[model samples]
Target: MITVSNLTKRYGSVHALGPVDLEIPRGGVTALIGPNGAGKSTMLTIIGRLLSGDSGRVEVGDLDVVTADSRELAKKLAILRQENHFVARLTVRQLVGLGRFPHSRGRMRPDDVEAVDLALEFLDLTPLQDRFLDELSGGQRQRAYVAMVLAQQTDYVLLDEPLNNLDMRHAVTMMRQLRRAADELGRTVVVVVHDVNFAAAYADLVVAMVDGRIAHVGPAREVITPYVLTEVFGTPVDVIEHRDRPVAVYYH
Candidate 1:
């Protein structure tokens, strides 16, 4: 399990995040949903060790995120930030191959190759493996980035705003693929998503944040209710059932 205790981040006197505690279980999809600047991204980045938090501890399994070795942490957890910038032009296959660096250290063995191939297949990017990242659409590029993270084969994966550039169909496909990654591959997936409906449909748990604090955390059916959502989003939300799942209707 991923555990957090009294985590906090500050800029001067302003609290960007924290004094927060959360525990994400070992093998399911957890979606963090909230308004802009609600600390979802801040918390995810801190957990992934890309950003440091002031005054608390974050543990992925038994390893302290603040103190773990970089290489060892890479093997234990893989994260894909919302904005990815690459100076060198790389093909889809080459990018995915980078995930194996923790194990192969730039010298890919058969197992690493197999892992890359499987990740490409999982993301439906096998056909585009040879294509340059610039050649693909935004959604396709997002998938490629996700494939790279998946290829790492880590026990925990944290994605920040993974649906940023995806269209409706691709967004659904992305959520389904994430769900599969958790169910079939037995990985713990934590994603920051703006769309509560998608979270309700795919996430095993929904963590609602407001102003740097987690307002609610529970199963989708329990947390996605109109009262909770409306309170979290600061807007009226109507709940409806579809496919035996609760979907929020906030856009009027």
Candidate 2:
């Protein structure tokens, strides 16, 4: 489990994130939902040890994310940031192979190759394996990045807006892949998502963050209501039951 205690951050005077406590369990999909600038990325980045917090403690399983060795943490937790930029051109297979660095240490063994192939297959990128990142469309590139994180074979996976460049079909496919990673592979998946209906459909738990604090944390049914949506987003929302899932609708 990922345990967070009194996590807080500030940008000079502005309070960017909490003194908030949260527990992210293993083997399930927990969707972090909130408006822009809601600090979802902040929490994820801090947990990944890519950024420092003003004050707080974060532990992934038994390892303190802050104190764990960089290579060790990379082996245990894989994070895919929202914005992905490729400086040096790399083929799809090369980028996915990089995920094995924590385990392979730049020496690609047979096991590493197998893992890379699995990740590419998982993201349905086998056909694009030899294609350069710059040659793929946005959604295809996004899938390639996700495959890279998956190849890390970590127990904890943190994805910031995994659906960013995906279209309707790809969005659904990406969420389903995440769901399988949790249910079948026994990996914990934490994602920050903007689409309320997608969160309602795919996530086991929905965490609502607003104004740098956790407004609500519960099952999707409870957090995906019209009242919670309106309260957190300050916009009128209508939620209706559809095939046993809550669907949010909004119209001006």
Candidate 3:
């Protein structure tokens, strides 16, 4: 399990996040959802050890995030930020191969090559593996990036807004791919999503945050109600059941 205890962060006088505690069980997909500045990204970054908490402890499995060795942590968890920029132009295969660096240390053995190939195939990027990143459409590029993280072969994967700029079809496809990753690959995926409906449909657990604290955490059916969503987002919301799953409808 990923555990957070009394975590807090600050910037000058502004309290950005915390004194919050959360537990994310291993396996399945857990989504962090909330309004802007609700601290979803802040908490995720802290758990990934990309950002430090002012006080408190975070543990992924038995490894202490703050005190664990960098290489060891990388093997246990992989995180993709909102914006990824590569200075040197890289092929899709090359970007995915980078995930093997933690294990290969810049040397590509047969096993590492096999792993990269599997990730490429898993994301349906094998056909475009030789294409440069800039040559692909936005959705395809996003898939390549995700394939890179999957190639890392970690038990835990954290993504910040993987659906950021995609069209409706691409967004649905991305969510479906993530769902497949959790079900087929046995990965524990944690994502920060803006759309509550997406979280309801794809996430096994929905963690809703308000201000800098978590407002609710539970299965999608329990947390995606009009009362809870309206409270967390400060907007009127109506939830309707579609194909046995609750979907939030906020646009009137």
Candidate 4:
């Protein structure tokens, strides 16, 4: 499980995040949803240990996120930020192999190679394994980045806006893959997603943030309603049952 106690971040006098307390259970997908500048990414980056909070503590399972050894923590949690920039010209396989650095230390062992291959296959990037990242489409490159995170084989995975640049079909595929990782591999998946419908369909829990605070957190059916959606997004939203799931219709 992941626990946050009074987590807060500030940019000088501006409150970017909160003195928010949250508990995320183990072995399921939790979707963090909110409008722009709502601090969804801030909270995820803090939990993933990529960003620091002014006050509060975060623990991933038994490891203290703030104090845990960097190499050791890398083995426990893997994070994919919203923007990915590759400085070196690298192929899909090479990028995914970077995930094994904690274990392999830049020397690729047989097990590391196997792990990378498995992740590539999982993301259906095996066919493009030799291709350079710049050669792939935006959606394809996003898949490659996700594949790298999966190759880490960590118990906890945190992704920010993973559906960015993806078409509807690829977006659904990515969500399903994350769902499988949680259901079959017993990994804890926390993703920052904008679409309420996708969260409703795939996530076990939905966390809504507003003005750097967690507005609501509950099951999809409970959290993605018209009233909650309207309040969180500051727009009129209609929830309709589709295939027994709540789908948000918020178009103007």
Clashes per candidate (backbone, < 3 Å): 0, 0, 1, 0
TM-scores for candidates 1 onward, in order: 0.98, 0.98, 0.99, 0.98
Q: Tell me the TM-score of model 1.
A: 0.98
What tens digits encode model 2's per-residue C-alpha lDDT throughout 1-252? 999999999989988999889998888999999988889999999998888999989999899988988889898999989888749999999999999999999999999999999999988999999999999998889999989999999999999999986899989999999999889878899999999888999999899999889999999999999899999999999998999999999875
For residue 221, give model 4's deviation from the true position in Å: 0.9
User: What is the overall TM-score of model 4 with all chains considered together?
Assistant: 0.98
Cα lDDT for residue 220, candidate 1: 98
> Can you write out model 1's per-residue Cα lDDT over 1-252, one digit (the tens) per residue?
999999999878988897899999999999999999899999999999999998899999899998999999999999999999877899999999998999999999999999999999999999999999999999999999999999999999999999987899999999999999999999999999998999999999899999999999999999999999999999999999999999999888
Candidate 2, number of clashes: 0
lDDT (0 to 1) per candidate: 0.95, 0.93, 0.95, 0.94
lDDT tens digits, residue span 1-252, model 4: 999999999988889999899999998999999999999999999999999999999999899999999899999999999888858999999999998888899999999999999999988999999999999999889999999898998999999999987899999999999999899878899999988899999999999999999999999999999999999999999999999999999997
Q: What is the lDDT of residue 114 in candidate 3?
A: 98
Error of 3 at 142 (Å): 0.8
* RMSD to truth, every model: 0.8, 0.9, 0.7, 0.9
User: After TM-score superposition, what is the CA distance of residue 47 in candidate 2 from its true location, in Å?
Assistant: 0.9
When 3 and 4 are scored with TM-score, the better candidate is 3
Better of 3 and 4 by lDDT: 3
